[model samples]
Target: MSVESIDAHQHFWDPSRGDYGWLTPELGGLYREFGPDDLKPLREAENVSRTVVVQAAQTVDETRYLLDLARNDSSIAGVVGWVPLDAPNAADLIDELAREPKFKAVRPMLQDLPDDRWIENPALAPAIHALIKNNLAFDALIFPRHVASLKIFAKRFPDLRIVIDHGAKPQIKDGGAGWQIWADGMAELAALPQGLRCKLSGLATEAAPGWTTAILKPYVDHLLKQFGPDRLMWGSDWPVLNLNGDYAQWHDAARQLTSHLNAPQQQALFGDTAKTFYRL
Candidate 1:
């Protein structure tokens, strides 16, 4: 078999679906619908053989919508769906979602929730356990402030596979004041033996306008060192990524950022790590 490359964190969303409150008009370019067909040519151009479509809206109906898409698209290796983790019937919901084989993970929209302590809510415990029982990973959709809490959450369920989306979204447009906090939080999270992974996505959008590969290298370097190639995954973060850069630009930048690593390590960062962490 040929060695594979996976774009482990892209999203498909439709404004007509109306669940995504974040897709506002001011968001400019990303204010439209995007689907697998829209991304196929881009992924093909970058030689990405597969992709993981993640949840863009905090709705179970959206999850169902994505699962339906995955069922029809051979290129979608897995889905990270949304479920109300603190719901009274969260476990039942997880069981119901588990019926779909393509459901590989759950991402509670922590970044959108007003309560930062929500992850620590005891009511979510059963749902977290259900994810473990069902063998579903937890995609942590969080910001830097949420990282310290995430470390504690990861410690609670030591075996639950966790991947921090967008490198916890460091503040790149501003100067690097947030770096220490984000870096410290990430180190604490990655230090957990529970197997934490980070995605090298969403960085370009965080940088100042007219950013380049050199501008992102430090952030990318920090992630590679903290998680290593074995625990780090490259994600297109697609359509949203178009806010700052195109797929080919991000792909080339990632390749250059990781050029120091040997062939095997590069492969691990590009595909193997995501394949194993998400069990894609």
Candidate 2:
């Protein structure tokens, strides 16, 4: 088989279906609908063979919408979606969704929740256990503030596979005052014996206006140094990417940033790590 290139993080959404609380008219170009057709050419242009469509909204109905999309779209090899993880029936719901072949993981939208320690709540235990029992990974949709809790969460269930989305979204644009905390958090997670990984996505948007590869290199380098290629995955975080830059620009910038790695290491970042982490 030919070696694969996967865009491990990406999404397809339509505002009409309506669970996207964050997708308001204020987001400008992103306020409209976006789907596989919109991303097909972009992925093809970068030689990406497949993508993992992640949840942009927090609802079972939205998960169903994505699962239905994945069923028809061969290029969507896996899906990381949402569920009410703290609900009493969360386990049963996870079991049902786990039955879908394309359903690979669950992301709780933890960053938006009021409680930074929400992932550690005893109430979410049932959902967390069910994910383990059903063989689903957890995509930590978190920010830097949640990193400490994430490390605790990872330890509580060491068997559950966890991938940190967007390198815990370091405070890049605001200057690197928080760099040490983000770096320390990554090191703690990476130091865990197993079942932890990180994604090199969403950094461009984190930097917001006037971001370049140079501005992002330190954060990227820290992730690489901490997680290493085996535990780090590359992703587009696209459409949201439109706010700061375009698809090709981000792809090219990532290429330039990681150019120093050898062939195998490069392959791991671009594709292999995501494939193994998501079991895709």
Candidate 3:
């Protein structure tokens, strides 16, 4: 009944490689340099046997770099790399990336942008279509206001698998507590048939510093109700999570959330959901 764990949303970046512009000194110690070697200790400490390396920079090179890292390191089970959705040859790029078994999905960072923009822009539709055709999933990383866009995008591409990262990134710290907007949007997205999953990750970062499970419970509870354990997955968000807590703390928090669930349910939340959705 003991379930093996997988950290579904960790990030590794080499500042010397000149990519992560957001890691500033004000954010504290962990941002200096994060790589596979640095994450090994955390993995051991948390009993996490597998991980998914998510893209931090807005480049395909990051994806290729993670795939190469995965080739050398067995711990990284998958890579959620980014690609320019508006690019003309995005379809071809996805086709090529799919050839690598470790490349599981694509993520375009949509949270930083404005709310009115369409994810299914005419130019991006072909690329999205290619993702569906190639069996690659798309990670919907958006803010609360943009959550409603998923409804439009999901309706446009019924065959594509979509994962809402960081529980649609609610503004929990800002006291956006009512959550009517995010909760309604999540419900609409989950109703889609193709496949919709949500990551129980990054909540600590979104909440006030020193926030505890009690503070995060409302958002986590909402996701559990909307997606259920079957559609929910766990992720550490690693170095970013270091902003609020260490890897062990975040892993333990997830474990505490699943403490009441049966072993099979725990397995699905900890690893199986990600494995099945991302084909890891």
Candidate 4:
């Protein structure tokens, strides 16, 4: 069988541009320039037919940058760009980006912020609705604490398609102290309309450095149980995975996790779900 795969999450950044201020040298491995060329070898090695590039910085310019890249590169099947959801012309931004067919969705990096910032901010709600109005998905880059607010947002806007990134970012490295909070929140979010799904990437990074699938199994199993295989998708989170492991290592772990599932279910996790949800 051909090893066709679709990477649903990965990022690109240019250090000369000074865009990713958060990427410090102390973080070690992933603090260098990462672009399409850096990803090509790994994609070919793993047989990834296409990839969905998610935004790393919070700038509209980054959105346009990815759109331009997608226009030139067929390997980049879609892009999850960022826009100022609470800015004055948020609706206009969404509408404008929707004109680009490769602009599959928008993501605000809410997970890295303080717990209470824009979880349910009134101003951002309308902007989120504008995403739905324009037929775009919203990637929820949220932590466990933000899940409750995410539940509220999902219920309030039943029509919007939202993909939960990083398996709701469970606290694997923290001895799973925050697992219950994340699991409960995921249950609530999963109960929302069929639009809700989660990405099975970044789990190894979430664990302590040099962590293994045994360390990540609980969190992965929990998401599969809560969202089911059809509502789940796989993402390599490459280059970023260099912070903890390599692309092959991460991909193998994901394959091991779902090795028991039948062929169709495995296909959804590998590619079809993302293609269907993101309209790639």
Candidate 5:
């Protein structure tokens, strides 16, 4: 299979594995096993040629499990697994993980951590350096409040290819609550010299129930204005997307929202940009 329309940020997890601390029965339909098999047909329906499976659990074992899955599933073009950046031997772990052919990036679950400024810690320099040395991307999974510190981190490590996951997960669920803050923060990051990128995923989950493409258009439009299609990439956010919508629904909504872009620009958002950012 070749890379064309890539789902740049989706995930798979087995609650039975007991690794995903955040997964619980309360999440309803999302509290079950979701693998490539479950998403394969849906992605095929939408012409998603390949996918980048991301981490759901914050454990290295889970990261290894995801890589093992990718090793066997050719459709999985990349894996954004996790490593404890605050650990003493984080550099060693990163070195070991980077040796895997499918490990394209490392996400530290920054959103779940209580410390919004965790990524700005100086203690993480060695691990981050190892990431730069290994030529891997950094997935910043954060909320609106963490944007300031992330900017500082981006400034300090200009060489680290940083990607803001879910557009820093804007507060879209509450009618774009704090719109100015999210907008200004995203614009600031986009203007930075580091060339920080962002994923066009997980917005459905962040949106209000019964949300439509119209509700997401403003946020997506803002992203295009800031990062442009060359720096933005599309993703499904899949099973979690079930929280608000489903796979095909979100894909359709994304297509509808971006329908106005010309062929080249649309291609960049759906595939080319991710291909370049993740070096797929």
Candidate 6:
């Protein structure tokens, strides 16, 4: 079966807006501005017709900005915006954001937080439950250190739709040490009867100086075995991907990496699963 491809994860930000505080000068090539116009041609050249823009800043205005961008750009299918989960009115904020049809999910910057157990904070319960009540997905944008917490979070809210972004961001540069721990945590989340999905993106950024499809394939293969095609999706992770690679390069590499799969399976990995998961 043929599928219209959707780039499940990418970001757009304007430094002039002062929202992306993390996009510091140290980021070099990625510190500059990136927007839909910059990404449109690259994605179009690769035949990726649509994309979901994830939030790059923790500010709620950044989410509002993305929703506005999606409102004007048809190629932008949906957004995974940020919300202050610990706020007393987080559920109210989620309900307000849910009114926008393009606001498909929420991603708290878990990797940056000092506390690994931040998700487990009782204060976050309302926001997490609001996600389920609003029918919005939760994009787990975390590193391997936080994977164990994710297993606990999933168990506590089994019915909430969750997708592990960047294969839980394993450390691949040094032969992926502590991989067993990541695998064990991922297995725990996948074991949830409510189901979970993983994205096959951001490995190149994680691997950095030593990045290669061959080095990344084992990790992708592991997720394939754990979640299957029906629960896995692909993402470009865009301009951030430019730190190590470009959109076209990652797109081509991802296609070649998953080339072993049959047509139906490939369709799901490249497009269908994201479309279904994000309701694109």
Model 1: ten consecutive residues of lowest lDDT: 186-195
Quote the positional error of residue 280 for candidate 5 in Å.
1.1
Candidate 4 residue lDDT tens string, 134-203 = 8899899988788778877787788889999988778888897877778898888888875599999888
Q: TM-scores across all candidates?
A: 0.97, 0.97, 0.95, 0.95, 0.97, 0.97
For 1-280, candidate 6 gives per-residue lDDT tens digits of 3459999999999888897868888988888888999998999999999999999999999999999999999999999999999999999999999999999999998998899989888788989999999999999988878877887888899889999899888888768788898888778777888899989889888885747788888888888889998899999999889888888888998999889999999999999999999988
lDDT of 1: 0.91
- For every candidate, C-alpha RMSD to the true structure in Å: 1.1, 1.1, 1.6, 1.5, 1.4, 1.2
Total backbone collisions for each predicted model? 0, 0, 0, 0, 0, 0
Model 5: lDDT of residue 54: 92
Residue range with the least summed lDDT across 10 consecutive positions in model 3:
112-121
Lowest summed lDDT window (length 10), candidate 2: 187-196
Candidate 1, residue 169: lDDT: 90
Better of 2 and 3 by TM-score: 2
lDDT string, candidate 5, 51-96, tens digits: 9999999999999999989999999999999998989999999999
Query: Per-residue alpha-carbon lDDT of model 3 for 48-159, expressed as tens digits?
Result: 8989999988888878888889999999999999988888898889889989989889998887655456685767888988888888898988877775666778887888
Candidate 2 residue-wise lDDT, 13-78, digit = tens: 999987799999898899888999999999999899899999999898999999999999999999
Candidate 5: the clashing residue pairs are: none
Which regions of candidate 3 fall more than 4 Å away from where they truly are?
A: 114-116, 176-178
lDDT of 4: 0.86
